[model samples]
Target: MEMVQMLRENATLLKLGYQFELPGPRMAATGILTRNQDQQRQKRMQERKAEEVVEQKSATSSNQEVPTRKIAEMVKHQEVCNKAQIRKPKTKKLKNGANEKESEDILKDLRNNLKPSVKSRHEASNLPPPQRSGRDDLMAAIRGSSIFSLKRVNLT
Candidate 1:
């Protein structure tokens, strides 16, 4: 029993090849360095295992806490409040070759004419082909029927 107690007490000193009261500071430093290295290795192994577990969790994200937001709660589109821009009419006068005037009636008449008109079934059939104004107005493209297929027949 006495021998076992002595051995247990001197275990660290014995491992460092020391005799009688732990030799010098150099030997003690060597032992400490080796122990520190072992601890560092264990720490590195634990970090590697932790990284692997995190990778697995990320790979299976569906079952885990999915960072989600309800699509319905989000505003899909916001109403665009366009600033009213009153464009100057290209024609400086009325259709009757009148002088330039900034009357409200003239402006209102011009605005009404500029707006696109949706033709009904009967109106579309009777609508005449729009004149190619060479401008980019959408109304210029609205034609009743295509004139390409209409060939003039001479009944002579």
Candidate 2:
């Protein structure tokens, strides 16, 4: 009887060891699920904020009669803002070596000064393309980097 009991215990330990050696997803917990949900929530929030800015710009434009000169300025401002926002990440590679914080400040200022809009007839006639892909802007960033500058000297 004692021998049978010892064999049963050994079998149970071997089964547990084999199970532990099996490879599978280790994060079988609620933490990963909550983290993913949080990321999705933040993404939704950013999209909503961008939409709100567009709506506000449209509302203001419709309620007020902006002169052609002002409209032109707004369009120019919007274009500049769009460009800055697009190039924000690449600012670090600039010849002057602007830091991340400065680029972020510039972006904040641009966003504060101008908002994007939905094209009404007047805006449709005047407006340029709303946004371009990152690939389209990559060459521009590379050309503007210090690597392309013949006049730049490395102090190091």
TM-score each candidate. 0.24, 0.25
lDDT of 2 by residue, 1-156 (tens): 333344344422221111222223222222334555666778899999999999999999897885789899999999999998998775337447887788889889999668755545577789787787898699777777785464666898
Model 2 earns a TM-score of 0.25
The runs of at least 3 residues in candidate 1 whose Cα sits more than 4 Å from the true structure, single-residue gaps closed, are 1-23, 62-156
lDDT of 1 by residue, 53-130 (tens): 998888888555643454433433222222223344455556676555646678889998887676555687797987
- CA lDDT, every prediction? 0.58, 0.64
Q: List the residue pairs that clash in candidate 1.
A: none
